[model samples]
Target chain A: MTRIAVSLLYAGALVVLIALPQLISVKYYLHLSILALIWLIVSQGQNLIQGYTGYVSIVGAGFMGIGAYSTTLMGMHLGLPVWLTILLAPPMTAVFALIVGYPSLRMKGHYFAIVTLAFNLVIFIVLLNFTELTQGEAGITGIPKPAGWLEALNFRDREVYYYFVLAVAVLTTGIAWAIVRSRVGQILMAIRQNEDLVGALGVAAWKYKLFAFVASAMFAGLGGALYAHYQSFINPEVFGVAQSLDAILAVIVGGSGTLAGPMIGAFIVIFLPEYLRFADSFRLIIYGLLLVLATIFMPRGIVGLAQDLGARIAGRR
Target chain B: MIEILQQIVNGIAIGGVYVLIALGLTTVFGILGIAHFAHGSVSMFGGYLTFFLVAGQGIPLVIAIPVALTAGVVLGMAIELLAYRPVRKASHINAFIVALGLTMMVEGLNLEFFGHEQVVIPTSFDRVFNIGGVTLPELRLYVILAAALLIAAMTIFVERTKTGQAIRAVAENRDAAILMGVNVRTIPLVVFAMSTALGVAAGIMVGALFAIAPGIGEGLVIKGFAVLILGGLGSIPGAIVGGIVLGITESLAAGFVSSAYKDVIAFLVMIFVLLFRPQGLLGKAS
Candidate 1:
C-alpha cells in the first residue's frame, strides 16, 4: 500500500470509527461494525502468521480463547481493570504460544497445522473441563468494561467500545505493516517459501518463525480480550473448531499475505453471514460456493484482485 | 477379557470406517498431493444418498449400497474434472482452497438435501454373534468384514492391474509417468473415482453402524487425516494400519479415559508418533 492509500485508509477508518456511529442511527449496524473490527484484528494477526510467515497456524481461536478467558478470569477474580487485563492478555498468550509453538513449530508445514489444531482442541477441552477457572460451558458473565477515560464517555455505550476496538485494530495493522515492510517480513516470506534456503543463508529461520507465531498469537489475544469486554459474556464455544476455521477463511478470502487482506476478510466474514441472512436457508451454500470460486479463480483473494485492477487502471494513466 | 476383546471388536468396526476414509485420503494425497478436504463431505454425500435410497426410495440395502458407491465414483470424477483439473498446475494453495470450499459446499448441500437429523441405513443384520464368551453385533461384523475385503481388493488392484501400475507410476513421479506415456489426465479421475468409491463404502458402513449426519463426516475426515498422518501420508497399508490403530486407540481411550476427550487422546497419540517418526508409522524417513 502506498502513502496516499495509507493516509486515505486511515482517514476513512477515522470517519467510520469516530463519525460513522453518529451518522448511523441504527445501533445494530454499529455493533456489527465493531464485531467486524475485532475479527479484522484477529485476521490481521492470522495474516502475519499464516499468510506472510507461510506457516498455517490453526490455533488462532485457541489463542483468542486463552486471551478472553485469561482477561475475564483475572478481572473477575483478581479485580484487575478491564483495560489492564486486556493489555495483559496478549503478552500472556504470547508466553503460552512460546511453549506451544516450541514443540509444534519444529515440525513441517501441514504437520504444524495439525499440531496447532490439536492444541486448539485441547485448549477448548481444558476450558470446558477445568470448570472452576473458566466456569465451563455455562461461560463467564458480568465482565466489566474498560473503566478509564472512556468511562467518562459512558463506556457502557457500544459505540465507545467500538471506538476502543477500532483503535486497537489500527494499532494492530500498524504493527503488522511495520513488521512486514521491514527485513523481518522478507525473511519470514523467504522462510515460508523455503525455510531451508533461509537457514542456509544463516538467517536462524526458527527465531523468525517463532516470532511470527508469538506475534500472531498476541494479535489473536488482543482480539479475544476486546471480544470478552465487548460481548461481556463468553464461553468455550468462542474457541471452537468452526471459529478456528473462521480465521483462516477470512485471511484466505481477503487475500492472504496482503496488508489489507485480513481487514477485508474480517469485513466479509463478520458481515457477510449477516447479509446472507436474506438468502435464508441457502446462505451457507452460497457462502461455500463463493469461497470455492474465489480461491480457485482468484487465489490472491479480493484485495489481490483489487490491486490487479488498480495496477491496470494506473498503468493506463 | 471379554470387555477387552469386545473393545477390540468395537475398535475394528469403527477402524474399518476410518480405513476406508483414510484410504480415500491417502490415495488422493499420494497421487495428487492435495489434502482433499472435501473427501469427508463427499463421503457424507455417499452416506446421505444411501439413506435416501434405502429409507426414502425404499431401495433394499444390498442394491442401494452399490448404487451409492457408483454415485460416489461419478461424483469423484466430476470433482476431479471440474474442481481440481483446471488448477492442476497452479500453486498448491489454490487447490487447497478449492478443497476447503468444496468441503463447505458439500456440507451445505448435505444440510440442504438432508435435514439436520441423523440417518441410519436400515439393515437386516441386527443379530449378535457370540463366540469364546465375546459378543459381536452382526452389523459390526459385516462392517469389519467389508472393510477388510475392500482393503484387500484395493491392495490387489493397485498391485496387480496395469492401470494401478500407471497410477502408482504417476504417484511416484508425474513427469516421469507422462514421459513413459502414461495418460496423466485419466489417472486423477480414476484415482478419484476409486478413492471416492471407497469413501462411499465407508460412509455406508458408518451410517449402518453409527449414524450419518452433517458434521459427522467432518469429524470422520479429521480422524481420517490423522490416520493418514499416523500411517504415512501416501501409504495404503499405512492407512489401513493407522486407521485400525486410531480406531482401537480411540475406543480404548474412551473406555478407559474420558469419553469426551477421546479425540484429543487420539490426536495426542499422533503427536507422540510425530515426535518419534514425523514421516509417519509406515512412511520412509525423509
Candidate 2:
C-alpha cells in the first residue's frame, strides 16, 4: 500500500539523518546540520500558529531569546544544573507567551502580526539595554553544555550534540504531528478557515488561539536553549527580528500547513546562505528575491509541489 | 517649562517625520487594504539614493531630493505592477507575504548599494535660532516646514482632486467604485506613487536629522505601523494625530524616564490603544 511506502521513506530519511554526522567528513557541516535542526524546531512551532492557526506571530526569535536567556541566567545566577535550566526554559517561555498572547490575540490578521513584531522589538531592546543581566551586545560566553550524562559519549563533540538536537527535533516534530491529527488541531484549522464562524458556533476561539501561540513559543524556547548550549555562547544579536523572519521564511518556503514543510525549510534557510558565500554581498538580496518569487509562483511550497506532481503521475498511470 | 518646550520642539521635528511615514502607510492601507510593509525600506532606499547623489556624486541637495522622489514614484509603480499585482486576488495573507519579501529585497538592495556604514545627508543649513530658551536648529526648522508643506499637499490631493475622490471611493467600497466608473486598476498605482513620495520625503528628513543606516528603516516602519494602529487602521487624520502623540510620548519618555527604553514605551502606548480603543482615535467603531 502507499502508506507502507510512505512509512518506509520516513524510516529511510531518519536513518540518513542519524548517519549524517558520521557520513560527512567536514565537522563544519555537522555544525550547520545542528543549526538547521534547531531551526526545524522553531519553524515547526511557527507552523502551528502561522501555517495551521492562520496567525503569523513574528516573535519566534524573541521567544527563543527568552528561552536562551532563561537557561543561561539560571545557570549563571542560580547555579542550577545546565540540564535543569534547559528543562525549565519551556515553561518560562510559556508564561511570557501567555502574558503577550492574552492581549495580542484579541486582534485578527495584520493587527496580530504587527503586535507580535513590536513585541519582538521589545524583546531585542530589553536584551540589548538590560546590561546588568544580559551583558548587552557583548553576550554571555562560556555557556556549559549539558554534561555528566553518558560519560562515554562526550557532549563537547559536534557529532554528539548533532544527535541530541536531532532527537529533540524528531520528538518535537512528532508532537506537532500529533497536534495536527487531534481534535484540537481540527478546531485550530477551523479557526484559521473562519474564526468568526467558529465563535458563532459557540467555540471559545480565543482559548484555542492562545494555546497555539503559547505552544509555538515553547517550541522556540526549546530550540533556543539547545542553540545556546550547543554553541556555548549566548547573544541577543542572533535572537532578533532577522532570525524571526528566518522562522517565517522556513515555514513558508518549506511548506506551511504541511508537517514535512518546516523540516525542509529549516535546511534551506540555513544552508542556502552557507553555499552562497561566493555572492556574499548579494546574499540577502538574492535570499529576499527567492522568498518573493517562491511565495508568488510556488505559494504552497516544495512539499505541496511534490504532492501535486505525485498526484499527476499517479493519475497518468 | 523651558525643558518641556525644548523637548516638545525636538519631538515635533521627529513627529513630522513619523506623520509622513504613517501618511504614506495609511493611504495604501486605506485604499488597497494592503499593509505595504516595504514602504519603510523603500523610503530608506530613497534616503540612500539622496545621500549618494549629494555626498558621493556631488549633486545639489535641491536637485537630489526631486530625483529621489521621482525614483520612489517609479519604484512604487513597479512594485505594484510586478510584485503585488500578481497576488492581488489571492488570500490576504499572500499579499502580506509578498510585502515581507519585498521589504527584504528592498532592504538588501539598499545594503548592497549603500554599504553598511551609516550616512547623513549633507545640508548647509547650520544656523540655530534661540527663541525664549528653546533653540531650534535651522535644519530642523526646514525639516518641519518641508514636512508641513508635504502634509498639506497630501491633504489637498486626497480631499480635492478627482483621482483622490476615486481613491476614496475605492477604499469606501471597491465594487461600488467599479460600478461608478472609477478605474480601480490605476488607483493602486497612484496611491503607491503618492505614498512612496511621502515616504521618500520622510526618509530624506530622517537622513538629514539623524542618519540612515541599515536597520533604521525597520524601526521606522514599525513606528509607522504603530501610528497606523494608534491613529486607526485606514484613517488619514488618525495617522496624523497618532504620529504626533507617539512622537511626543517618545520624547517625553526619553527625557523623563529611561532613554534606553524609549522604544518600549512607544510600543506600550500602542498596546494600550489597541486594548482600550481598537478603532483608533478618529476611526469609526467597526
Candidate 3:
C-alpha cells in the first residue's frame, strides 16, 4: 500500500508485459494479448463513467463502432495515412458522444441506462442497415495496417502489433489515471454518490456527468480505432451491445473504480471464453452464473476482494 | 387509405404484445422498484417451453400453454427469492446488474434447451376477415382479443382485489404498507407471479403470431422498456397506451418508410419523447 510498493508493483507489471511476447510459446496467445490490451483501453474508459461516475453507459461498443468506422472510412475514401485516420477517430467519436450524452445525461439511474442502451441498438441498426456506408454486415475487410510509418518493424507481425498496442494501452491508462486523480474525477464521484446533494451545493452535476460520458466515449473510440487497425477487419458485429456488456463485465469483475481492475478484467473477459471452450454448450450459462455470483458475492470485484483480504491480514499481523 | 388501415391493424397486434411485456415490466418496477430486465428472456423461456411441449412432444396447444404459464409463475418466484431478494438492501445499481446477469442466464438457458433456431407455435387459426376495406387475419384478431382480455383482467384484479390494493400501497410506500399490516414479504412473490404470468401470455402470443428466436427476447425487452418510457415508467395506463402507440409507430414506419430502419425510427421517437416530455405521456410531471 506504500508508494514504493505501488511503484514497484507497476514496474514489475511493466516488465512482465514487455517480456510477454517473447515468453509465450503460442502466437495465438499473443493475438489474444493484443486484443486484451485494446480492451484494456476501453475498460479504462468504461471505469471512468460506470465505475467512478456511477452511470452505466451501454453504448461503449457503439462509440467504438463509430470510431472504427470513422477510422476505416476516412482512410479508405480520403486517402489519408492510417495514423492520421486513427488520430481523428477519437474526435470524430466525440462529436457523436456529445450529441448522445447531451440529452441522455439529463436522466439518472435506470432511465439513463435504458436510454443509452437504445442508443447502442440504434448505432448497431445504422451500421447494419446503412449498407451503402457500412457494407451491411458483410463488413469492411482488407484494412490497411500502420505499416509505412513503422517500416523498421513489420506491423503485421503479431508481436510488433502487441507491443504497439501495449504502448497505447499504457498511455491511455495513464490518461485515465490522471483524470481519476484530478478535480473532475472528484466531482464525478460526488455526482455518483448523490447528484442532488452536489446540485444543492451549487455544482453543475450534469456538466461533470457529461464530461465523464464524453471522455469515456473518446476512450472507446481510441480502442475501436486500434482494434480496426490491429485486426485489419472492421465489422459492426464485433461492436454491438454484447461487447458493451463485456466491457461492463470487465469493469465489474476486475474491480470498479480502481486503476488495476480493468487491466486484470479486460484479460479475463477476453480469455475466459477461450478457456471455457471445453464447455462450449454451457459457456453462456456459466458466464451468466459467474456474472450473477460476482455481482452478489464479489460486488467490489477482484481488486476489492484482494484489498479486503490484505487489510485483514495486516490486522491479524 | 386501406393500406394505412391495414398497417394500423398490424401495429395493434404487435402493440398488444408490447403492452403485455411493458405491463409485466411496469408492475415489478412499480411495486418492487426492480427493472427486471430478464422479464423478456423469461417470457421467451415460457414460449419455448410451450413450443417444446406442443411441437417436440405430443401435448395439445391448449394444454401446453397453461403448463407453461404455471411454470412461468414458478420461475418468476424463484428469480425474486434467489436472484433479486439477496440484493434488496444493496444499491439500485446492484439490482440492475443482477437483472442483467439473470437476463444472460435465462437467455443462455433458452439457447441450451431450445437450440438456436427460431420456433413458431403452430395453430389451426387459418381464417381471414375482410372489413369494409382493410383485412384482418384470424390469428392477429385472436392475439388482439387475448391481449385486451388480459389487460382488462389485470385492471380489474388491481382495482378490485385486496391483494392488488396491498401492491399499490407497497409501491406508494413500503414502510407505510408494512405499518398498515400488509404482508410485505409475500407481496414481491405475488407481483413476480402476476408479472411473469403476463409475460408468459405475451411470449405465447409472440410465438403463435410471429416467431420466437434467440435474440428476439432481448429486442422485445428493449421495446418493452421503450414503451415504459413512452407511457411513464410506473403508470399502468401509460404502459398500455405507450405499447399501442409504439407498435403502431413501428408498423406505420415500416409500411411508409424503410422496413430496415423501423427500429431506428422507433428509438428516434423515444429519444425525442425523452427530450420534449421526460415525464412520459401519462407520467406525473415531477
Best by DockQ: 3
Model 2: per-residue lDDT, tens digit, A73-151? 9999999999999999999999999999988998888888889999999999999999999999999999998985676
* DockQ of all predictions against the true structure, Cα-based: 0.58, 0.76, 0.78
Residue-level lDDT of model 3, residues A214-279, one tens digit each, is 999999999999999988898889988889988988998899999999999999999998987889
lDDT of 2 at B234: 89
Which residue pairs show backbone clashes in model 3? none
Residue range with the least summed lDDT across 10 consecutive positions in model 3 chain B: B88-97
Off by over 4 Å in 3: A148-152
In candidate 1 the C-alpha lDDT for residue A63 amounts to 95
Q: Please give me the DockQ of candidate 3 compared with the native complex.
A: 0.78
Q: Can you write out model 3's per-residue Cα lDDT over B1-286, one digit (the tens) per residue?
A: 9999999999999999999999999999988788899999999999999999999998999999999999999999999999999888877777887888899889989999999999999988999999988889999999999999999999889879999999999998999999999999999999999999999999999999989999888889999999999899999999999999999999999999989999999988988998988878899887
Better of 1 and 2 by TM-score: 2
Better of 1 and 3 by lDDT: 3
lDDT of each: 0.87, 0.92, 0.92
Task: Give the DockQ ranking, best first.
Answer: 3, 2, 1
